[model samples]
Target: MQTQLAVAAYIIHNNKVLLIHHQKLDLWLPVGGHIDQNETPDDALLREIREEVNLEVEILNKLDLPVEGKTKKNLALPFYTNVHSVGDHDHACFYYVCKVINPEKININQKEIKNFDWFTKEELNQKHISENVRNQALEAFKLFEKLTK
Candidate 1:
């Protein structure tokens, strides 16, 4: 089975979360992508945020997920268990809480996504978001709320 390494971020601000409407999946998801061969998960995540949102973020380490073992550092991340889907390339995602650190306007690339939006938790929970994304958005929001409170 092929493995893929990836990193994701739950960008939060004022009880709102940023999500992208994926063109392929037709679902909203946090920003993320495959990790390059020479970079760390943190680096890959930051790069993905820049590519996806056109903004710089300050990653807060407090709410980040546990990293995979050091032995698997350079190994391909398995997607079977890391995500909701299996048989596809496996991936290990590093989820972090982040805030926009710069004031640049967003310029989303239309090739990978349809649109982007910032939604409150209330709107997300009551809307038609995918099950996986809904759960993730809720969890990320909960963690973020905890940190601020």
Candidate 2:
């Protein structure tokens, strides 16, 4: 199975996580896409968020380790990583928890996303949200709390 590198973000605002109903795949998922050639994961994630929802986000992660030499920059760490099936292909996805920077500016790309909604941790238990997505969303909340506090 071919696996392509991808990035995803669980955007948090007002104690809720945003999820999109993918038009093509017919699944509710976090906003993200494959990393472009020669582009860093951070760049890909930012670009994906911009293109998908037309909003800015702040990745909530504990970047910058004790060892600093030779490192030009410390990229935001993913809260989770996994290889998941995407029909004919698989995506090795890096997942991050992000805080919404511009809450009012959101325009979903209708071509890729059918609809979007912000779900609280309690609301994520609804049957329509997939198990995988629910778990990720919950974990994102934990990571956001741990990192931002």
Number of clashes in every candidate structure? 4, 0
lDDT values of the candidates? 0.72, 0.93
| lDDT at residue 110 of model 2 (Cα atoms) | 92
> What lDDT is obtained when candidate 1 is compared to the true structure?
0.72
lDDT by residue for model 1 (101-139), tens: 663567786888799888898778756577777777787
Off by over 4 Å in 1: 62-81, 86-88
Error of 2 at 98 (Å): 0.3
Best model number under TM-score: 2
The C-alpha stretches of model 2 lying farther than 4 A from their native spots are: 65-69
How well is each residue in 1-149 modelled by candidate 2, as lDDT tens digits? 89899999999998999999999999899999999999999999999999999989988784567656887677898989999999999999999999999989999999999999999999999999999999999999998887778
Highest lDDT, which number? 2
Q: What lDDT score goes with residue 38 in model 2? A: 93
82 in model 2: Cα distance from truth in Å?
Answer: 0.5
